[model samples]
Target: MSCTSSSMDIVPDDTFNDFAPLSKRRRVSDCSRSCEDSSCAPLKKFWFPDGDIVLEIQTRLLKVHRRRLQCSVIFSDMLHIPQPFETDQIDGCPSVALVGDALADWEVALAWIYHHDEFLNQVVTFDILSGALRISTKYEIPGLRRWAIEELSSRWPVDVVSMRLNALPHAAEAITLAQECNVPEILPAAFYALSVQKFHASADGGRSHLVLSPNDLRRLIAGREALQDALLRIAVDPLTEPGCANNAACAHCAPRRAEYWRARLAPDPKSPWSTWLVRELDWMLRDDAFAGTLCPACFHGHMSTIKWRLGRLRGAMPGFFLL
Candidate 1:
């Protein structure tokens, strides 16, 4: 069931809790015929804050998630009845991968503008997993972000899922994407733990490789009093501090067994809390690893702390720090 509305509300998944184990990996057999076409052209790769995402997106042909055996067989029969193409053609056609671009690309496409319509025609496949988990990494992509929103309304698995704060791959990217898309539900898993962690801050800490800036540390203190009361919160904690690996998946990372046990109580069918996950956040926080995405509330808190910190530094050195 694909959305026809320009601003389609995402597929709704009221039946499942966010904390519940995500649905299983989609099989190659489950894909649609258009998605499966070998001739589909991949989306062009674009530059973002982090590494080359979707570097090979358009190269791969897509298939529908194979829940229907009959459909698959029929599609295969149709595909085998080959049709001719221009002999000079070296490139294939476009696929849905092209749809994922700057957020503006989505507005153009969804609005059915001619250029975007051409862009959509080029797309022959749509990744059912929606790459929300992928978005949860260092930075989010708008096309992918919108896709995830729609996917959220339907039942989909957390493909390649992980919440171990420490050593969590693409954690920062995922969080950033979530925040950009205005998907607040996932915010708790993304940033709260870091809000309560220790920190060493580089100015505008988030701009560079640093995750939880010094500003972030102060914000954490406000939410969890012990962080500041413990004395030099940022100075003491290794995980939350820069130059320290926040990934807890490594043998060196401290385990959070108690948090793991506590997480089981969540995933209730009757409450919004079911969509909230903390075992991973707790473990990450306990490990002192700060996930990258800062929710609106958290972002505001960090801004406040930075303003305060800068003000304090200015008072100490009239020439060096300015308000």
Candidate 2:
């Protein structure tokens, strides 16, 4: 039941249908069935006698008011349909079976719907946000879906600069979620975050949870190589440092600056070049001592060149991933 990507496997493509009809609904699997009588218990927190409709999930039922769900086009249409004679009833309320959904997803979605004010004010977890996103997309709830996407965007931004600033946890899971759901925009950022992480083989020789799908692995490798190439090109490019007004001092400092860059920017076995560009740039810019040996003109020029080239690379990251 852990929602973190590190503990989960890649979700299959056909795991959930976006708008499956109720007529084609499949019965809950026998393993998930609570008892021999095929009866389901009400979920403790969501059950309410005063609620108008009862929703039957795999092993539990949830009673919620019609008004709360009517905002969703799919839910509204489903609710208006006349119930058949065989339709189950819970405490005189018509019960509808929800197909192709996980109970956890519904729990998160329903909690948000019923207590949105409180939920919005509270610190949201990835589990709650991802669950809400999945359920809202299934039910065609635009408002909740938008809210979930916007919340996720803050952590995994579309642009490279913001994405570098906001590091996301469980990036592999986020990538899977993007592929499974319709959130393609966050894929580039998620993939970039995953690329720099070092995943080791499991002790038992089993597949690691951090392992990505074959296609994703290919894309990650290609994109990471592309980024590394871009960084290397920028690092080795000739510096256009026109001698400052004090030409002698500036000329003397130039060779030292080149040597410093060669030593500091050289590729390290432990650290990836793709991730080092920003970190090194920040280090040099933050502390004047790092760039103190160079003349002001040379220092500013080198920094500007690094920024410009990296910015261009960042812009092309999505294309590098074949996205």
Candidate 3:
């Protein structure tokens, strides 16, 4: 049982009845008979001892305590009902069919309930954290859901460029999973990273599979184009020189400096505009290619202008990504 981001799905809203009795509670005899006659005896031995409830999860029987299930409001209400029969009990407790999710998901959820401290201390993997998130969200367990979200969000960098650089292993998956789980805060950076990275075919045959939704796809595409245009405009704008205060310096050096920058910062047809924006901005200000030709006032003024524009660009990044 391998767990990948692709295995994460939106836990159905109706999976757990929060306001009413569980629709799938099976008879104690049926659940107990299956547990006794099947391969679940080993799991029963491990989790069922002194357990008050039998949860038939898929083909397996998971014996869990009612006190542990009470941690979730959904489960608490589901388990609050009186037992139907004392004589039909298995291990001196009732049985219920826990439907919707697979046994693996329940395993993770139950582990979080019974051994929360240990689970939190363990090195959290994507599969485990994702399972916790799905179950927590399904059962309305706020603490577990918050923990899962924090763990997942930690994998993404706050800086957009860093996210773009590290996009390969998780960004696409993060975008898909975040949307599936209804976590909007994680989408902005993930979407920005995907927009800046080179588009590639996924296992689903195209990049379309990674998009959160049609609206999100539209926003990413539009934002990327807008950012490219904005960066190109900033790179090429002749206003970078900011009319030299020293008239003689302006007359002697402005034209050549402007010409040098225009030639140097010209867009590369092969590379993304974001790559050019990130890789060339600092060099454009630092490079001494035209230093020998420009006077002090003009050079300082131009550098200040470029720096100011860069600041503006940085400030506008969140808006560009619809953050």
Candidate 4:
């Protein structure tokens, strides 16, 4: 009966459907939104709520006696790269910046830093050259680099590509700084291929072929691996989510979704999700932090893949795995 989860609460699978029931009339998921902003408010009903939904079906409402809806339901049918789900804490974009003082030798340090952050596709800034040099790659420097990496990755993901393309005389320390502040995007084969062609132009005869060949991109995707803790699942978009209509990368959403139900249904008598969910709602309503909004079926169909992949590796892996 011990409590689990950040907040000890409990709920059952049988009751999960009660909170967000799909209306028989609409037959689609209700699009309810919530955020951290105090002034911002979630819609009382979903975009296509069965009854009195503000925005439904994009159909025209009564022009003469219209309810005079305050806001329009903007359907974001973005292409190429759209934003991620609102629940996630971080965006998948990489943040890179140049960092170096007016008087500092940043050759070796900068290159190594660049390579490290570049390889991880994380944030990097050269302005903190002194701080970067302080990070000992050889010796174990407890707080300097290790903690920063954890903190930033937990909050935001930065793009190292932004740094490589933007800065000159690569500064490793600066890149590490940005990486320390944010994680980076794990580009997929299709996206990388497109990006290479977009930026690195092709040349004929005396021209330079800057684009990455198909084989190079293949090797890149093949070599990619999951996070050490199974905490992060870096999947190439469209590969797993072929029919997905939205655009954006959400690394945390997948791996975390993979385990949410299991975590709640592990048969702990105390019941982590149900108990805390109600309690949190009660507390948040009083504190005015949040309301009925909960994560939709994002976890659906995701847990199986996470478990299956973990099972394959766990049988031969070490004990330190977070699984």
Instruction: Sort the predicted structures by TM-score, highest score first.
Output: 2, 3, 1, 4
What pairs collide in candidate 3? none
Worst 10 residues of 1 by lDDT: 1-10
Which of candidates 1 and 4 reaches a greater lDDT? 1
Give a tens-digit lDDT track for model 2, residues 106-181. Answer: 9888878888898889888878878988888877789889998998777778875566534436576777777877
Best by TM-score: 2
Residues 1-323 of candidate 3: C-alpha lDDT, one tens digit per residue: 11111111112345343422233322333433435654344364336577776665566666778788788877665555443343233444555544556677777887888777988889877678778887887777888888888876666545443343434445566777877777776665666566656554342214644545667667677767876886566556554434334233387676776676567666555653235454355667777766645678877766776666555655666677665
User: Which consecutive 10 residues in model 3 have the weakest lDDT in total?
Assistant: 1-10
- Scored by lDDT, model 4 comes in at 0.26
Candidate 2 clash figure, as a count: 0
lDDT of 4 by residue, 202-297 (tens): 211012122334443333223222222232222222114333333222464545433443343232344211122111212322332111122334
Q: Pick the candidate with the highest lDDT.
A: 2
Instruction: Report residue 184 deviation for candidate 1 (angstroms).
Output: 2.1
Global lDDT scores for all candidate models: 0.30, 0.64, 0.60, 0.26
Model 1 Cα lDDT, one tens digit per residue, 99-138: 2333333332222222345644453222322243233221
Over the full model, what C-alpha lDDT does candidate 1 score relative to the true structure?
A: 0.30
Candidate 2 local Cα displacement, residue 205, angstroms: 16
Model 4 stretches with alpha carbons more than 4 Å out = 1-134, 151-197, 201-218, 221-323
